[model samples]
Target: MSSSPIATVKRELLVRHLEAWAPAALHRARRVIYAHGYADADGGVSAEAAMRVLAEQSDLVRGRELIMVATGDDLGAIDPRLKTISAESGAGAGLAVHTISGGTDGRLPVGLKAVGAQRVPVLGFLDASGSEPPAPATVAALTAGKPSEMLLVLPPGSSASSVDAYRAGWPLFTQVELADSEEPGELLVYATTAGKSLEGFKEALWSVDEFAGVRYRDPGDPERHLIDISLTPHPGPLRRELLAHLAQAGEATVTELRTFALTETVYRAADATRVLHTLVDAGTVTRRPSHGRLGGDVVISA
Candidate 1:
């Protein structure tokens, strides 16, 4: 991919957008369940999102192991990109299209079935254009007791209640995120079982010159930060990177640090607080008084 500032920010947005979630959703994914209204030219937006996830995971996967399940009716007849992406020798995957019907609220998508049976980790990308968003029971049934996550794109002005219900049913995760994009007028909802990155997702797109001006939602919560960075190989340097941001900013909220990691640094929002706590632990930085062990603003030591 091109390293242009916008492209770079977008890619980081996509990755950290996901990185705040489960490990299975990215590096260790075994299957990808893609559901969309119909296959569009050039494989459609669903394919593009799935491709981004696969590309993000390419460096981690060895040999062809990941399996992709999509709708059969339209999928088999159009767009070969998914087929090509699945057939690669190393990081590519294998494709399976399940017979799926469209344009109804009650009709169940076959992709949901693929997600349920898998014992391996999964990344479910659902585009709710052809049909209404899956019911909460549906999402819960597919993700129950498994390390799984889903990214959904629904029609604009979608019912907050419906999205809420869809999120409420999932047993694995408690956070339900809603994001807006201008071009599509689409509502993007990301729900994961492990972590949160709403702040980071918003940060990746807004940029000025060399600075990708993405900010964190909350910087005071260290516990959440710990959960986010645990997925990465080295938490130490990532933490330092967060500290450096704090040093530059003088003193910032926990959410600000999370934002920095999501866009400015090659780290997740969780990484910001993890390093802040480390600095506080070492007596190198001072934190606001009485915000609990993991909560409070932080200042770089003089």
Candidate 2:
């Protein structure tokens, strides 16, 4: 009757990055407004994550706020706790949740003028089930600078077939695809207007054993039908925290580490693995049963 644990797990993965990205983003601007409030049937995980982010980064987000946008008339779909936090947060000021009559049709519920009124970097996110993503204008302002970012969650479908739509929605930002048709029913596609492709995200996952069964691709890459997102991008603090988690848990299989990270921290198995080989090179960790570049048995160094 409920969504699969894997679905929740993956959604949380997105949320953790948002939490991680918040403070760093704030450094570039005086205020930050993070928006997400669509397709939140499973307890509004994204909305809750934003609230948790506000709670976690109290010092940096004093004047900054997290704006959550939800559309449609399905009151039952809305999470009551979001309202509770909103009421207690800033009386609809900071951490305000706005309910609109239409979906995230490529514009903030408050309109671009309202968003520009803040005069700060903006990060917009939408998880839509339909073929239509946020209209280009909804995300246009954020694309001008690298600091501004937009994330789109596409339901399972022909990812490559709709590459045109993704390219159109994101404007100049590189259209980085995060999934394919393999996991048909899973929350299977991610397109981000990020400075770098999620190569690090993919590589980090590849370095772990649990993700061996996972295959992420793009229609345009050398893999043709399956896009190879193999690149070594920096994972930042995610790598540090993941290593700490592994160290605390001791030498374990990749699957074991993945389960630990998923339950205990914001860093997922993939995002945290960006620094795995780096640590092995620096002796922060030692590869046992030496599997070379494949990322086999790992042991934390003393």
Candidate 3:
């Protein structure tokens, strides 16, 4: 099936995350559950891509159990494709794939239980279409404890309250807007309580290959700036955010600032240092112990 470039990018984002998160999660949780909403309808690209990763990198998944629960109205097309992928990849005996033919509302929860999700870590990719997103209860179920994470693709103009409701219990939550040419596109929401999982996601977000005529928008940015998905993305948004954070705190250590960037903002912790050094060079902000390299111990004031 032919997929639009932007749609393909979204799938790649999920695959890239699984590539990074699955290995670490297997080591930490002993088992992994991947629940896909709208699996067959979207051609099962993400599930297929993710399963291929497990197949190709057998060493990382040797002992750990990986269960993939794919939910869709019908699996007539995707089921065969998935079977072929598993067969060709020669995925290990430990890997299990379940195709639930029903609405995600009822079947997703059932699939989760059938796989012992409560006892293991789960990575749910709720690829919601149009205005309707996965229910708040569905999202809450995924955030039951640490190491369980959820990713949602919400339509444009989705309510802030809907997102807030989805983010309710998670200690860490972040979203990136997929731009559609000139206008803002769908929103990709990620919620989790695990710091390591969140860190892995952030790495995946910036590392995915750049798509033409598309850029990711920092939803937190007031101007709704569209930025490229690159290692050294423009730090304009971080610059403003740091100034506001410094204004409120009066002064903060480099470590504190870096943590703020990591936890509270879309920018990575490494971006914090680069923006700070630029600010200091411009004389917009001052750093104590300015005579030496910008270490974590150095303090910054606006």
**All models: lDDT?**
0.46, 0.49, 0.79
- The C-alpha stretches of model 3 lying farther than 4 A from their native spots are 57-63
Instruction: By TM-score, rank the candidates, best first.
Output: 3, 2, 1
2 or 3, greater by lDDT: 3
Best by TM-score: 3
lDDT for each residue of candidate 3 in 157-253, tens digit (9 for 90 to 100): 7767877888777888888888866576888888787877777788888888877777887777777777888989889888888998999999999
lDDT score for residue 261 of model 3: 84
Model 2 CA lDDT for position 139: 49
1-302: candidate 2 lDDT, tens digit per residue? 12454444445555656666667766666556666635444456656666665555555655665555554324355657666766664424545555553545533545534644255555556666434545555545444434455555566654555534545535223223334345443333333444243433333333422222333433223332332323433344445555666657666665555544433332345544555666666777766656555353454342
Per-residue lDDT of candidate 1, residues 1-302 (tens digit)? 23333333333444554444323444445454434333342244445455545544555555424444454235444446655544452353333433344422233334555445454455555555334555665455446424555555556456557666776644332221122222223444555454443343334323212324222212222322221112343565456556666667777767666656654443456656677777777877777762476653543342
For candidate 1, what is the lDDT? 0.46
RMSD of each: 10.4, 11.7, 2.2
- With a 3 Å backbone cut-off (N, CA, C), the pairs that clash in candidate 1 are 86-93, 203-214, 215-259, 216-255, 216-259, 218-254, 218-255, 219-254, 219-255, 220-254
